[model samples]
Each structure stands twice: as structure tokens, then as C-alpha cells.
Target chain A: MTATTTVLISDRPIDPDRLAADFRKQTAGSGAIAAFVGQTRAEAGAVKALALEHYAGFTEDAIAAIVDEAVSRWPLHAVSIAHRIGRMAPGDPIVFVAAAADHRRAAFEAVDFLMDYLKSEAPFWKQEVSDAGSRWIEPTDRDRQDIRRWRSAPHSGEQ
Target chain B: MTTRILFFGQLRETAGRAETAVDLPPSVATRSALIDWLAKDDPALHAALNQDSVRLCIDKKVVLAEATFSAPNEIAFLPPFSGG
Candidate 1:
């Protein structure tokens, strides 16, 4: 059963180890725990930093909706998602998604589902800053495709 | 009816401001109507909203293009999300 759910959006860098440990404590008896840490790409000089912006009231609500949907669909014991807002330097932690469940597959898939939606569904905007200048980053075609799969019924072997 | 409209990210940059409380004229009631009304005065907002990349959230949830929303409170126009 899904026990604790954490959705956080902040300007500070995320501590993946702490987040995982907290979730592990919350889901003590859980069989499997899955964690993912998404960091800013270090593309040498190509991208210097990433600036993130989010709507104040709506960002939290949107993430809550995503978490609720995931909990409903899976038997997750606990889940935590943390994303950074404002500026983050290259290789800084950008996002963290973790799930603990009685089984490995459920924990793994729930994190994936939450992340795909977090990327395409949540209300966040990013700009890449480099020597050339700064420009707003848009979701790529793959991101759109990734989120669409969640709309249809969950089938086996779906990417 | 009054709607507190919000612009985030690139939408804010394009609109040249953060948010506005617009009193919807009887002629303009829905989100689409509001966009059309602003487009007349804000060419950049008009251009930005015209792109399919933009999205609308009434209150806090995303609304489909065809959804009808009564004027109550908040409405946010968003650029493509690139969170994580």
C-alpha cells in the first residue's frame, strides 16, 4: 500500500541520498526501492547552467495530481519526487524520483511513470544559459511520445 | 467577471509582465476570448499564444483547448515545460 508521498519543488539542490534514506525509513518493510537522480548535463562549454521556473500555486497541485495518479495505479509503499527551481549549475542535481513497493517492478515503473509525466506534464519551464546566450528549452518529440503512452491503457513491453 | 490571469516562463517574457486581473467583458468570457482580446494590444503575447507550444491552466489544472471555464479566479498561460 502506498504510505507516504512527497512532492517538492525548490531552488536548492536536492540531496538524493537523504531523500532515499527517508523513503526507506518510511517504507521499512517494503521489498523493493527504486531511485533516480536526474542531474544537469555537463556538456563542457555547450551549456553553462539551467534556469527553471514554475507557477507558484499550480506547480504543486500539478505534481500532486501526478503522484495521486501513480499511487492509484500501483501498490507503492512510498514515493518522493524533488525538483529544483531557479538556477542550477552544470551537473547539479535537477530532479529525484523514488518509490518503494512490495515488488521491484512496481517500484521501478512508478518512478518511470512519474518522471515521464514530470517532464511533460508538470508546469515548469527551463532556459539553457551559455556564452552564446539563453533560450527557453522546449520538450522534445521523444518527451511528448513518452507522456502519451500513459494515456492509453498500460500494456506490457511499452516504452 | 474577473479572472486573474498568470503568465509563466517565456509567456511572462512575451507578455512583458507577470499577471493581470482582467475584467472579462460580456463579449469575452472564455480563455480563448481572453487571448483574442489581448492579442489586439499585445502582439508578442499574441504571437506566443498562437504557437501550439503554449498551454493553459485554469485554477491549477491543465485545460483542454475546447474546455469552457467560467470566470472565477486564476488562469495561467504556460510555455513548454522543461522541468525534469
Candidate 2:
């Protein structure tokens, strides 16, 4: 099967619907599709905007490797990820992940893994532009905890 | 031998510059040594580099402080990521 594996980083907005349609077209035989969109929140009016910075050539490579690892451990028919850079307002979409597989379980698991990997491991930094003045932010402790779920079982189940 | 060191986010703010091309002295060979050498004059940068939260990337891939490469390579230092 000719499946598409896309990992994209853009300074422009990402279209989740368009990406979903493209993945569906590429993984024609897949019966299940799972998608996740990460949006910026207002943080109780603390944040006016969020500026994201990436290590250029490295950000894509790091994300691609994470995608490769996911495909290697899952029976995925297609996988697509998009991360937006630059300034984004609250309630704006910041990231998207989509995966397709023959079964719902595989698609769900792959998308879950993809999100954790992107949040913790990808080489992108974020700064909150606020009335308190801008400050760079780090992954929350919860993010680190979420990522740990995949460590002990990197390849526990596969088809 | 020279290498281009890049800084991002908070680290960039601390360094007050985006990139610095440094000519490596013979005494400064490894990543660890390079930091110590660069930190000689700048206390803020020294503190920042010595911070456990500092992360490094060589030629765009995350690597350990022990990782080594030839001159003219690109190296980046960044703080903890907050990407979603």
C-alpha cells in the first residue's frame, strides 16, 4: 500500500480538514482515522499571544524521527502532523495530528503517541506574550508525565 | 577551527544575540569545554549554560554535551521547550 507520512512545520495556519481529506485519500483502505488538534488557550486572560520558535533544520528532523518511531511500532496506514510557528492568539490552532489504520485501536494509539512526542521532544520553544510582559515557557510537569507512558512500552504491541 | 553557535528563545535573550561564530581554541575541544571557555567573561551566559535546563543541538539534532563534530558545524543552545 502506498501510504503517506507527512510531517510539516509552518509559520502559517494549518488546515485540519484539508489534511484529514488528504490522509483519507492516501490511506484508502484504512477503516479508521483519528485526529487531534492542539489549540492555544487564554490562560485566564494571562496570555495575549503565544510566540513559537524552532531550531530551523532541526525541528523538522526531530519531528520526522518521532513520526518514524511511531510508524515503526504501529500498523499505521498513514500519519500526518503539522505545527504552526509565529504568533498565535488564544483559541487558535497550534498543532494537529492525524493517523489512519485498519482498526480504531491502532489509529488512536498512534495519534496519542504522536501528540506526546511532539509536545515534549520536538525542539520548539514557546513564549507567552502577556500584559505581565513576555516570558518563555517550558513543558509542564504533566507533559513530562504524559510522555512517560510510552517509555516502558515503546513497542509492546504491534501487528 | 570555528563553529557557529546558535541561541533560541530565553537563551537568545540571555545571550543578546542570535548566533555567534567562535574560533575554537585547542584547549576547547568538546561541548563541555566550549561552554566553559565561552563563559569566561560573561557571568549571565555562564549561569545560563550551566543551568541544568539548557539543551543542545548539533547540526540540528539534539545531542549530549559529549558529542563532538568538526569545525564549521552548527550548534544550538535552548531552554526547555513549551511546544504543543
The most accurate candidate by DockQ is 2
Instruction: Judge candidate 1 at residue B70 and give its lDDT.
Output: 72
Error of 1 at A148 (Å): 3.2
Give a tens-digit lDDT track for model 1, residues A45-138.
6999999988887789889988988888888888899999989999899999998888898898899999999888888999899989888988
Residue range A9-113, candidate 2, lDDT tens digits: 999988877877887788788899999999998999989999998887778888888888888888888899999999999988999899998888889998999
lDDT of each: 0.84, 0.84
Q: Give fnat, all candidates.
A: 0.84, 0.88
Q: In model 1, what lDDT does residue A77 have?
A: 86
The runs of at least 3 residues in candidate 2 whose Cα sits more than 4 Å from the true structure, single-residue gaps closed, are: A1-3, A155-159, B68-72
TM-score of the second chain for every model = 0.86, 0.83
Clashes of each: 0, 0
Candidate 1 runs further than 4 Å off: A152-159
Q: TM-score of the candidate numbered 1? A: 0.90
